[model samples]
Target chain A: MTALQLDTKPNWFMANWQQLAGFGLPVLAIAIYIGDDIVEGGARLFLQRLFDGLDNGAIYAVVAVALVLIFKATTLINFAQGELAMFGSFLAYVGAVTLGLDDVKVGPIPLGLLLSIVVAMVISAAIGAGIERVLIRPFDPSDHLPVVLITLGLFLILNSLAAFVWNVNPREFPSLFPARNESGAQNFVEIAGARLFYDVIGTYIVLAAIGLALYFILQRTKIGLAFRAVSSNTESARLVGVRVGRVLGFGWALASAFGTLGGALVAPKLFLKPDMMALLLIFSFAAATVGGLDSLIGAIVGGLSIGLIQSVLVGYLGDNDSAFIILSLAVAFVVILGVLWTKPAGLFGTSAVERV
Target chain B: MKAGSDLAASPEALWSEVEAAADAGWPQWVRTLNRTVLVAAGLLLLILPFLVESIALRRNASLLVLSLGVLGLVVATGKAGLISLGHGAFVGLGAFAMGAFVDLVGLPYPLALTASFVTCCLFGWLLGLIALRVKGIYLALITMGLAVVFPSVAKRFPSITGGTSGRPIENTLDAPAWTGLTDSQTIAVRYYFCLVVCIAVFALTRNLLRGRIGRAMQAVRDGETAAAAFGVSIVRLKAGAFGYSAGLAGTAGALQVVLFPFVSHEQFNVFLSFRLYAAAVLGGIGAIIGAIYGVIAIVIVPTLNDIAGGLIRNDGRGLLDNDVIVFGVGLILLTFVSPDGFAGLVQRVGRRFSNRP
Candidate 1:
C-alpha cells in the first residue's frame, strides 16, 4: 500500500511557489490593470474585494473538503456532490420554511431551525451512504468509467429531482445568522471600511466547528481508523479486518454533511434554486484540484486561493463590461488548467504512481 | 476474459476476429437477414420525412445531429478510452463558428460547415495539448470545466453570439428550384440534408474505427504502456482522437445550425454536456449502433415526457415526465443492468438467437 504521509510537512512557499506565482501573477496584473481606480479609492476597494472573495472562498472550501473526503477514501470524484448539497438545502428549506419549524422554540431558545437543518443534513448523509453502498460498491474500483458514469447520472438525477420537487423558481432562504438588528441597522463588523457580514462570520465558525468535530472523529473514533486504513489501501485494510465498505460509506456520509452545510450557507446569498450549485461545483472542483484532491487542508487553501483569484481578477477585468458578469467561472477554469499543467498532483496531494 | 487473453497472446488474431465476426462468422441466413433489415431501415428512413409532420422531421433532424455528437463520444471515450465531458462545448463552438462564418464572413453554407469543422478540430487540438500532461479523472475535470466555462465565454462576445438572447443565422440551405418545394416545405430538404451528412459521417467513422488507426487507439485504451512499448506515439494518438472526436461534434453543430438556424450561449450549458455523456453511455459507448439508440432514447424520451407530463400535470405543477429524471434513471439502470449499454443488450439478444442454430 502506498502511504500519503499526510502528517509530513513541506515548507509551503517552497512546495507551491509555482502555484503561488500563477495565482499571484494574475492578481498583480489585474491590480496593475485597474491601478487608476485602486489609486483613487485607496486600499478600501481592494480590501472589500478581498473580503468578498474570502467569504466566497469559505463556501468553496466547505464543498471542496467534501470532495477531498470522498477522493481520499475511494479515489473517485463524486460529480453529484454539489447537487446532493443543493438537495439538502431544499430539505432544510422544506423543514424551516414550508413546515415552519423555525417558529418552534425550546425554553427561550429557538433551536427548531437548527434542529431541522441537522435533520436535513442527517437525511442527506444517509442518502450519500446509500448511494455508496447501492450504486458505487458493486463496481470494480480500478475501472473508473462506471463510477464516472454513475456519478454523472446521479448529478443529473438529483438535479432534476430537485427541480421537479421544488420547481425552477428561485426561493428565498433565511440566513442562519441575523441579517439586521431590531432597529434595522445591518448587523456587520466593519474592518477597514469593509463590512464583514455576520453570516460570513457564522459560516466560518460553523466550518471551524465541523473541522474540530471531524478531527475528533478521525483521530479518536474506531471508524475513523477504519476509514483512514481503507483510504490508504482497501486491500490491506480488508486483510487487517477493517470493514472497508462501512468505512467508505462513512466517508460519503461525512462528505455529504459538509456539502449540505455549504449549500445551506450559500443559499441565502445565491438564492435557493435547482441550478444554484452548478457554477459553485466548478469553483469547488478548481478548489479541490488545486488543493490536491485527497488533502483536506489543501482543499481549504485551494478554495481560498481560487476564490480570491476569481473575485479580484474577475472584478478588475469585468469592471468596464457587464458582459463579463460570469468571468469568475472562466477564472476557475483557467486555474484548474494552470494548476494541473504545472503540478498535476496539486499543491499538497501525493503524486500517484501508475502501474503498467 | 477470453478476448483479453486472445488480445494478449496475439494481436493479429484478435484483429481478424474483430474484422471478420460480422462477415465470416455469421451464417449465410443470418447475413441475409441482416442485409434485409438494413435495406428495410434505409428505405424507411428515406420515406420517413414524407410521412411525418414537419415538426417530427425537425425532431428527426435533431436526433440525427445528436447521434453525430454521440458518435464523437463513442470515438473518443468508447474507442480511444479518453473521457470527454465537454463535447457539448465543441458542438456549441461549431454552431457559433458556423453562424459567424456564414453571417459575418459572408461564406456559403458548405464553406461555413467546412470552416466550423476546422475551427472545432483546431480548438480541440489546442485543448488536447493543454491536457497532454493530464488524464483519467483530471482530464474529465478539465473538460467539464471547459463545458461550464464555455457559455460565459461565448456570452462575452455580444456581436458574434448576440449576447444572452443568441442570434439567428440566415437560412442559406434552402431547397433548390428543382425540388419544387415551398418555403415551409423546405423542412424535408433540411431533414434530408442532415440525414445524408449523418450517413456519410457514420460511414467514415465506421471505416476509421475498423482500420489500423482504430486498432492503435484501442491498444492505447487497453494499455498505454503496452501500446507505447509497441511503438505507438501516445501523444499523437490521444491528440488525434480528441481532434477527430471534436471534428465529429463540430459537424453535428453545423447540422444543428442547418436545422434550427439559431445559436445561443444558453444552449451550450454544462447540462448539455452531461446529457451528451448520458446519451453516449445509454446508447452504449464505442458502438455506432449504440449511438443511434442513445439518440433515439434522448429524443423520444423528451417527447414522451411532454406527453406524459401533460396527462399527469396536476395543477400544471408536477411535471413527472421530466427528461432529466428519465435520463438519470436510464443511465443508472443501464450502468447496473449492463455497462455495455443498449448496444450490448442487443448483442446479447443476437447471441442468444444465433447460438441456437
Candidate 2:
C-alpha cells in the first residue's frame, strides 16, 4: 500500500509537469522565433527581462513585506501604503528641487542619491508614525472592516492631497545611477554579440542587497523576534512584555520607509505622478495574495514570480498593456482556487483557527 | 432591529406634533399655498419640453441614466448589504449588449434593452454566488478585483467590443408624426421617456423596500446568522438582490447608449464604479429617495465646479485638480457627521421642524 501511494505521488507530479509543459511550449516557441537573429541577443533579452522583473518584484516585495509587518502586528492591511509611498516620492522631488540638490556640479552621483534617499525615508517614516498615532490608534483592531474603511478614506485624502500639492503632471525624476557611459562617450560593449545593459546590473545589485538586509534583520535581530511574537499573538506578546503598540507603529514606519525606497527606485523608470502607483498597488495586492498575505518569504517569492510571468508574457505575447491585468486576475483566480482545492489557509499561510 | 423600532415611533409622534402646531406655524392658507407651489413645480417639470430649448433637454437627459445607476446601488449596497465596487461591469455588460443587439444584430431598441438587462442579471447572479461566501472587506476586495479585471477582458474580443476605441450606435429613436416633433424635439421626447422610467423605478424600489423581500434583506444585513435561523435563504436573497440591481444598472446603461450616440470601454472604467458608490453614499445609502438626491448631487457637483471655474475666467484645470480633494473631504465629513447621508439628515431636520408642538 505504501509503495502504491508513493508511486501515485510521483505520477501526480509527472502529470502536473506535463500540464505545465503543454502551456509553456507555445511561449518558448514564440521566444525562439523572435530571438532567432542573434543567439546572444536572445540571452541578453532574457537576462534584461529577468533583471527588470527582479527590480519591479523588489518594489512589490518591499510593499508586501510592509503589509505583512502591519498585518502581523495589528491585523490591519494598511490600504494607504501606496498613497504613503506616493507622498514620499513627492517629498523626494521637493527635496531634490527645493533643496537645490539637482545641480549637476554637486559632487558625484553617490552622495546626491544617498542624501535624497535619506530625506525621503525620514519624511516617509514620520508620515507613517503620524498616521498610526492619529488615525489608527482610536479604532479597535478586532473590528477589521471599519479600520480598512478608515485606511481607504486616508488613501483618498492622501491621493487628493498629493494631487492638490503637486499638480497632476508627470515629472521627470533623476536617476540614482549616472547614465553617462564609463568611457566618457556613448558606449555599447558587445559581449557574445549582445549588449549588456548597465541599468539591469545596478537594479539587480540593489535588489539583492535590500533582500539580504531584510532577511538578516528578520532572522537575526531582537526587534525581529518581538515583531514575530506580536504578529503570532498580540495578547501573548503584551503579556510577555512586548510593547505591541510601539511594535505596530514601528512596522508602519518601516513599511513607509521601504515603500519610499521603492518609489524612488522606480520613479526614474516610470514618470513620477500622483496616481502612478494606483495600478502598481493593485499588482502588488495580487502579488501579496499569491505570496500568502502574512508570509514575508512568500511575498518575496510571489513578487519575483509575478514579475517574471508578467515580463515574459508581455515580451513574447501580443499587446503588453493587458499583461498586468490578465496576470493579476489569473493569480487571484489561482490563489482562490488553490484555497478551495487543497488548503483553505493558502499556499504558505498558517491555518487560522477561530476559537469562537 | 433597534433602528426599525425608532423609525416606527418617531414619525408618528412627529406628525401629531406637526398637526397640533400647525396654527402657530404658517397659516392653513399658507400651508395650502405651499402645497400648491410644490404641485405647480411638478407640473412645470412635466411641461418643461414645451418651454425649454432642445439643447438643455438633451443635456439633462444624461442625468436620468445616472439616477438609474444610483438606484441600482441603492438595492445592492443599501438594501442587500453587498458592497460591489464593480457595478460598472454590469452596466458595461448591459450597454455592450444593447449596442450589439440594436446595431449589429438588427433588433429593436426596446428588445435590445431587455437583452442588456438579462445579460447583466446573469452576470450579477454569478457574482452573487461568490458574494455569498464572503462578507465585509473580502467581498469588497473581490468585487474590486472584478472591476480591475473587466476592462482587459472586454478589450480581448475586439470584434465584439470594438477593441479599445468603441463602436457607435445609429439613432434608434424617431419622432412620431402624431407628436408634432422634429429631430430637435427628439431630445425632449427622450427626456420624458427617461423621467417616466425613473419614476417607475423609484415607485418599484419604494414598494420593494416595504415588502417581505426587502425586510428579509434588511434582516440579513442586520445579522446573517439570525436571518438564516428565521428561514431566510440568505444566498438566494443576495443573488436575487444582485440580479435586480444589475438589471437596474443595465437599464441605465441602455438609456445612456440611447441618449449618447456611441458606446465604448472608456464609458465604463473603474472610476465609474467609484462614482456610483459616491453617488449612492452622497444621496443616502439605504433610502430610495436618497438615491435620487445623490444622483443629482453627483451630476451637479462637477457641472457647478466647471461653471464656477468658467465664471472666474480661470481655466478648468485647477477646478478639475481640486475635484478629488473636494470629493474626498466631502465623503469623510459625510461619513463622520451623518453616516446616514444627506437625505437622512434632511429628513431628520424636516422632522425636527414638524415636531415644534
Candidate 3:
C-alpha cells in the first residue's frame, strides 16, 4: 500500500497533463539553451542575466498593465500610451533637474526624486483623463476609426512636441536609488556572485506598492466598483446608474499614472529622450497581446516573459549590438504573431463572441 | 412613342433629350465648358514639365510617387476597412528591392520595378494572413509594428539594403538613347515617365475597383458576416486587397528610386507612415482622385513653412514649425470636421450647386 501510494502521480498533474506539457515544452527548450550558458560561465553569469531580465521586466510589466487597463475598459489600444509615458518622464526631468529639486530634502527623508516622480504621475493622470473627456468622449465608441485617428494623432503630436521642447538630445535622469555609498563603494548586494543594484530592488518595491494601491482602489472603493462595472459591461453599468463617462476617465487616469511610473523607473537606465519609449512600446504591446489584452495578471506575466525572452534568448544568440536589438524586436514580433494566430484572446483573456 | 423608343435606345441621346427638357437645371453650354476645362488641364499637364524648372519637375514626379503611396492606403483602408499604418514599410521594401535587382542582379529597370511589386505583394500577403486572423485594430497594431521594425530589419541586411548609410542606385532610368534628348529634356522625359505610370496605375485601379471583386470587397467592409452569408470569402478578399495595395505602394517606391536613385532605411520610418495616413484622411480616403489631392496638400506644407519662417524672421525649425506637426493637427482637425475629407466637401458643394439650378 505504501509503495503504491509513493508510486502514484499527483492528481493535479494527472488532471493538467496537457497544459503542463504545453507549457513545459517551451520552458524545456529555453532551459536547454540557458543550460549551455550555465555550463560555460557558471551560475554567476546566469544569475546576472536573470537579474537584469527581471529588472527590465518590472518596467515592462508596468507599461503592459497600463495598456491592459485602457484595453479592458474601452476595447481600444492607446497607441499614444508610450508617448504619454515618455512625456511624463520629461515632466519628471523638469521637476527634478530643471527645477533643481534633485538634491533638496524634506524633513528627515530624501524625498526629492520621490516627490518629482509622484508629481509627474499626478500631472500625467490629469492629462490622460482630460484627453478621454475632451478628445475621446465626443466620438462614437462603436465606430473605431475616429478614436484610432485621434490616438494616433495624439501620438504624433506628443512625440514631436517633446522633441521640439527638449530637442532630440538624450539627457541623464537621476536615479531613484543611490548608485554609490558615502564611502565611495558601489551600492549593490551580492547574491551568489551576482550583484543586485538598489535601483532594481526599489523598482520592484514601488511596483508592489502600486499594485497594492491599485488593488485596494479597485476592490475596496465605490469608484473602482463603477470602473469594473463599466469595463465588464458598459450598457449594463449605465443601466445600474453608474456614471460611465467619469468611470472611464478614472480608468484612463489610472492607466496614465501607471505609465508614468514605468517611464520614471526606466528613465535612469534608458536616459530621458523624446523617442525613448518607442521600441519599449513595441515590446510592451507584445507583452499586452501575449498575456491577454484585458487581463491584468496576463499583462504582468506577458511583460516578464517578453523581457526574459528578449534579454536571455537574444542575449545568448546575439552579441550586444544594433543587430542584437533588431533580433530581439524580431523575436517579439514573432511572439505576437504566434499568439494571435493560436489564441486571439490570449492565455488570460476571454475570447470575443461575435453574434451573427 | 416611336421617337421616345428611339431616344431610349441611344442612352446618350436620351440623356441629352432629358437635359433639354430640364434645361434650367444643367445647360449644354455648362457641360461643354466643363469638357473644355478638363481638356485644357490635360494639355497643361503634358506641357508643364518642359515649361517648369528642373527642381519643380522633380518635385512633381515625387508628388506623383506620393500619390501612388496614398492610393495604396486608400485601396486597403478605404475600400476594405483594413487600416494599415505601415504601408511605408512596403514602400521601403520596394525601394530596396528595386535597388537590389537593378544594382546587384543586373536586372533592367522595368523588370526591377515588376520584381519589386511582386516582392512587396508577397510580403503584404504573408503579413495579412497572420494579421487578419482576429479582426479590428489588430491589423493596425501589427502594421504599425512592421513600420517600426522595418528600419532595424533593413539595417541588419547590409549587402542588399546598404546597411545604415543607404544605397545609391546607378541611375539607370535615364531617357532612352533613341529619344536623342538633351540633359534638360531628359528631366521632362523622367517627369513624363512618372506621369504615364501614374495615369496607367490610376486607370487600372479604377477599372479593378468597378468589377466583381470591388463589389465583394465593399460588401465585406459593410458587413463581414452578411458578406460571408452571401458567399464572399472574407479572408481572400481582405488578403488580396492587402497584397494589391502593397503592390501599389511598392510601385510608388520603385518610382521614388527612379526619381531620386537612392534608397535608405531611415526614410521609411513611422513618421512617413503617419504622414501617408494623414494625407489619406485629409484628402478623402474613399475617392481615388482624393489621393492626388492628398499628396498635393502635403507637398504644399514646406512652402507654407518657408513663408511662415520668413514672416517670423526665424529658422523654420521651431515648435509647431515642422511638417509632421501640421500633419498631426490636420489629421485631428479632419477627423473632427470632415471625416470624409476634402473630397466629401467637394462633393457636397457640387451637389449644392447642382441642386440650386
Candidate 4:
C-alpha cells in the first residue's frame, strides 16, 4: 500500500497575473474562430458565448457539489440525485398550481415558493434517509455494483413515481429572482468596449455566493471535519467512535438539500418535469469527473469550466448536429486522459493510497 | 437420506402406493384436471388468432418487438450482472444493418438478419472491452454516453443512414399466393413468427441458466475475485455476456424493423434504455421468466393506461401520457415490496401450492 501524498508547494505562476494572461490569450483567439466565418459578429459572439457557458457551468456546479457531498461520506455516487432534484422541481410546480401560489394576487411572487422549497427539502431529505436505510444498509459496502444497481433501481423508481404523481406536463416554475424589465434587459453595460449582459452578472453573484458558503462550511466546521474523516475511511472513523450510519444519513440529507436548492434555482429557466434534470445530470457528471469527484472546490471549478466551454462551443461552432456531442466527448476524453496521466486523483482531489 | 432411500425403492413400491392412492381417491379426476388444463392451453392457443381483433393484433405485433428487446435485457442484467444503458443503440445498429443489407447490398432477408446480428456482436464486443476496463456506475455512464451520442453519429452519415428522418425498408415478407391467406392473416403469420422466436429465445436462455455457464455467471456476479480464484476468466465471461446481450438486442432490432418497416434514431434513445432497465427490475432482475413478465407488463401497462384514458375521456393527459412514470413506480414498488420482482412473487406462490401440506 502506498501512503497518501499531499501537495504542499504552490507555484508562484498560479498566483501571477502575467502567467494567467499568457494562458488566457490563446484561449481567446481559439474562441474567436476556426474553419468557420471569422468576420461577422465573431468577437461579440465569443463574449456572449463565454457568458452562456458560465451560466450553464454554474448549474452544473450546483449538481456536482451535491454529488460530491454524498460521495465524500459514502464513497457511493447517489444515482438518484438528479431524480431528487427533479422531484423537488415537480413539488415546486405542484405548490404553484394546487395552492394558487403562482397567482400574482397572492403577492408579486407566489407564497407557495417558500412553502414548496421547505417541503421539497424535507421530502428530499426523507427520501435520502429512506434509501440509505432501506436500499443501501442491506448491501455490503465492498460490493460496489449491487449498491449501484440498487441506486439505479431507485433512479428508475423516483423518476417514474414523480411522473405518476405530477403527470408529465411541463410546468413553469416561478423564478426565485425577479425578472428584469424589457428596457433593463435590452441594455448591456460596456466593459473595456465589450458588452456585459446583466443576467450574467446575477448568475455570477449566485454562483459566487454558493461557492463561498460551501467553502466556509467545508473548511471551517466540526461537521465538515467529521465528514472528511468518514469519507477518508469509514471503518476507521467508526473505530474512532463516529456514528457511521448517521454520518451517511447526514451526507445523503445534505446532498438532497443541495439538490433541492439546485432544482429551485434552475427549474424556472427550464420548465419543470419529471425528467427535467436527465441531460443536465449528464453534464453535471462530466463536470464532477473533470473537477475530480472527491473535491468540492474542484467540482465548482470543473463545472464552471465545462459550462464556459460548452457555451463557447455552441456560440462559435454553431448548433450543427455533431458539434455539441463531439465537444462533450472531447471534453470527457481530455479529463479522463488528464486524470490517467498527470493526476489520477483529479486537479483538486487529494492523492490517496490504494491498499490491496 | 430418507427421501433418497424412498426414491431408491420407488419404481415398484411407488407404483403400488400410487395404485392404492388411486383406489382410495378419484385418480380419474386428477387426470381429468390435468387434461383440462392441457386442453384449455391448446384451445387458447388455437383461438387467440381468431379472438384478437385486426386492429389490436396490429398494435400487439409492434409490441412484440419491444418484448423481444426486453428479453435481450434479461440476458445482460439478469444473467450477466452488466447494466447496459445503450442497448437502444445496438437495436438501432441491427435495424439499420438489416436495412443496409436488404436495400443497398440487395441481400435476402435471412442473410440480412445474420449480417445485422454479426455487426451488432462486433459493436457489443467493443462495448464489452470498455466494460472490462470499468465496472458498475462507470460502465452505466459509458453506455449512456454511447446511447446519447448514437443519434448524432447516425446523422453524420445521411446517405447511408437516411439522417434524422431515418430510412424506410421495403416489406419483403408479403402474403404468398400459395398460402392463400387474407392480408390480416399474413400479418398474423408474421406476429406468430415473432412469438415463436421470443419463446425460443426464452427457452434457450432458461437452458443456458441451468447449465455450467449460468452457474459461472452467477458466481462472477456474486464475487468477481472469488470467481477469479476459482479459475473463471472474469474478463472473458463479462465480455462474452455483453456480446450475447448485444446479439440478442440486435436480433430484436431486426425483428422490429421487419414488423415496422421503418427505422430511426429517435426510436432508440436513452429513455428507451431506462425503460428496459425498469422493465427488467419490474419482472425480476435475475430470473429468466421475469424478463418475459417484465416485457408483458411494460407493453400491457401503458396500453391499459391508454384504454383507461380513452374510457374516461381524459386522453391520459399529463403524467398518464408519460410511460416513464408507470415504469418508475413499478420499479420502486418491486424493489421495496418484492425484490425478486412480480414474476418471482408469482413463482413463490406457485411453489407454495406445489408443496402443499
Worst 10-residue stretch by lDDT in candidate 3 chain B?
A: B1-10
Give me candidate 1's TM-score against the actual structure.
0.92
State each candidate's clash count.
0, 1, 0, 4
Please report, in order, the local distance difference test score of every candidate based on alpha carbons.
0.84, 0.69, 0.82, 0.69
Instruction: Residues A1-356, candidate 4: write the lDDT tens digits.
Output: 33332232244445545434543654676756552543465666666666668877888888898898877776677777898888876776677667766663455444566677777778888878777877677667765555655666667667766666666688877765555344545545666456565555656776787788777766698776777788998889999988888778877877887788788778877788877887677777777766777888888988898787676654556566366755665554444433333344456877656542
- Give DockQ: model 1: 0.63
Candidate 4, CAPRI quality class derived from DockQ: incorrect
Model 2: per-residue lDDT, tens digit, B61-156? 676577788889889888888877678877787778888888788887667777888888888887687555665555666666666566667776
Per-residue CA lDDT of model 3 for B34-70, tens digit only, reads: 4564467457668887678998878767876878889
What is candidate 4's local distance difference test score?
0.69
Better of 1 and 2 by DockQ: 1
Query: Which stretches of model 4 miss by more than 4 angstroms?
Result: A1-44, A94-123, A126-171, A174-187, A192-194, A319-346, A350-356, B1-47, B148-167, B199-216, B226-232, B299-323, B342-357
Instruction: Give candidate 3 misplaced runs (Cα > 4 Å).
Output: A1-35, A106-110, A180-184, B1-45, B177-185, B310-316
Query: Candidate 3 lDDT, tens digit per residue, A239-299?
Result: 9899999999998999999999899889888889988998999999999988999898888
Compared with the true structure, what per-residue lDDT tens digits does model 4 show for residues B1-357?
Answer: 123344445334533443353234323443354346445643554456788886776576666666656767777777777877778888888888888888889887777878888888888987686555565555666677666666656776666578779878775555668989987787677667666766676677778766667766766775566556556788888888888788878878887777767778778777777787777778777666567667667767888778654432233444456566567666656665677677667655554555333
In order of the candidates, what TM-score does chain B achieve?
0.89, 0.83, 0.85, 0.81
Residue B242, candidate 1: how far off, in angstroms?
0.9
Rank by DockQ, highest first.
1, 3, 2, 4
What RMSD, rounded to one decimal, does every model reach?
A: 4.3, 7.3, 7.1, 9.0
Model 1 C-alpha lDDT per residue in residues B205-229, reported as the tens digit of each score: 9899878888888877877776676
